[model samples]
Target: MELKPIKTRKIYEEIVEQIRELVVRGELKPGDKLPSERDLVERLKVSRASIREALSALEMMGLLEVRSGEGTFMRRLKPESVIAPLAWMLSIEKGTVQELLEVRKILEVQAAKLAAQRAQADDLRELEDALENMRQEIVNPELGGEKADLQFHYAITRATDNKILILIMDAISDMMQQMLKTSREKLYQGKYTPNILYSEHAQIYEAIKRKDPKQASEYILEHLSGVEEELNSHIE
Candidate 1:
């Protein structure tokens, strides 16, 4: 006898779907702690591995948060909640990094310009501090560079004193780091990376130091556009 077609899914994947459905359906609100592992084990009738895998998927989607030594809680959903899915999609969709960077390029360049025009003395000091940290990281090539780089971008946005702008840019911090790593990879392939970025970053710092909005904006556009061009050249 011929066998009928079988329908199947990885057990964890199905579990993940159910949990996400509950969350989207409002059965699980933001900040709600999920049931304990043992409770889920009995409810889902799945192995520990399956349960763990489902939880991992949910965590990656920003639908849930797991605190060390504490229970998992749901995160506040909105645009921020969408970031995880966007990031995962970008990873799967071929040739989208350049587009992602372009978006950041536009947002950040505008923020940089505004920051320069609006920044007060205290803002300038913060920006200078971040810049100095970046320089030290470059010179020493320590693992601390990522934090410094993030602070550098943040300083510019903070200088703008636009709470919304600062928040939005902060949300995309992960994406920025991802894109920068990719850009650096492209540059590394051509032996054109490390020194080049350090100098360009310095130029932006200099413009900010002078509080020249026009020059800061121009330099930011030029720098980010160059990165986009260099990446698209090969991947396209």
Candidate 2:
């Protein structure tokens, strides 16, 4: 509820920054209603147009939800919603798919290690559910397990309990999913069978469940490296 007056020429960007800072400081949270435009203008000593522009940008960033006649409220952040804008830009970038996997190896390997150390019972349940879903997908190829694969990784990030790490995962989730879908298709067409993929995931899950951080990290790295190798083969 602390609204400072804006003195900068880029008034809207300043507004966005302040609001974002509030969020980072835990002042604003999901479902909290923002001040009215009139209220914001007066509080920030800015024009209504500046307030509107900032609000629009925040909405686009998936940070706010503007319901009809209900004012604007802080949105519950979802990986897909938060990263949609960034995903669009990354989708057009050269060699982004390869880069995405490289980033994934870095993030996910550490995430697996942390998850092995910190995962709670609820986190274990989610990981198990995702693994079960993967098994089901393998049994019935029509079901498609790509979603389960993504969910498993997301559960690992959640288990880490690091907000910044979780946010970075959200930022890349869309592109990650696209990469998974394409890579899996190419891999399946090659020597990599669906069962092989499922086995690799299962091994990682077992390592985490055993609370063996070293094993979990190793398993995940090996799995990711294999996927990268397969994808490279197709590209080459």
Candidate 3:
């Protein structure tokens, strides 16, 4: 109920905070439609632009879903959604890209190790499907291939069966997607051929399929390091 008239210069941010607070406090439960934009502007005494901006921000955070011809509704937000504010900050901060990649390497290395030991038939099928998607998309632009690459990594993480690790991965999924896209584009533009990329992923898949945790971890690390080198080469 701290939803008062806006007094701050960052009116949109204040509005976002108040609405988010209400949702967090259970004042706005899941599937509860919010007031119209005009009504919200009138109630908060803020400009229409500010209200729109606030709602858009909340939508990006997965807190609100805006339906066409219908009002916005509160969503049952995930832990990843709650971490979005931090994720945004990390995305733009200096030197954060390297830090993010390093963290990804650490988490994914462990994930790969665990996947090697615990991956069931379903998990193996998922990984194979993802890899096949990547292979099929190699002749096309990197967009579809990049998406499949992400799916492959996510499958490995799911194979780990660690909820906390999965949540952490979800929290940084956006940034990770961007990084993969950039690295892949750079690799394609440079020395890497489509076949080379396919080979790298296939090697990793083979290691995991063999249930060799050590080999899986090593292959994934090497693949990531190669990607890091490609990115660094562009910077230099």
Which candidate ranks first by lDDT, i.e. highest? 2
lDDT of 3 at 72: 94
> lDDT-based ranking, best first?
2, 3, 1
Clashing pairs in 1: none
- Per-residue CA lDDT of model 3 for 1-236, tens digit only, reads 44699898988878877886887688889899998888888899999999988888878878789888988998887766777755654554534557777987999999999999999999999999998888887676544577788899999999998887887777677777877776776777777767787788888899999999999999999988887777778878
Worst 10 residues of 3 by lDDT: 88-97
RMSD of each: 7.8, 6.1, 5.5
lDDT of 3 at 66: 87
By TM-score, who's the top model here? 2
Which residue window of length 10 is worst by lDDT in model 1? Answer: 1-10
Ordered from best to worst TM-score, the candidate numbers read 2, 3, 1
lDDT of 3 at 108: 96
Error of model 3, residue 146, in angstroms: 0.9
Per-residue lDDT for 1-236 in model 2, tens only?
79898989988878987987898799999999999998998899999999998899888878899999999999998865655444434544536667878998989999999999999999999999998999898779998778999999999999999887887887777777777787778989887887998899889889999999999999999999998888889889
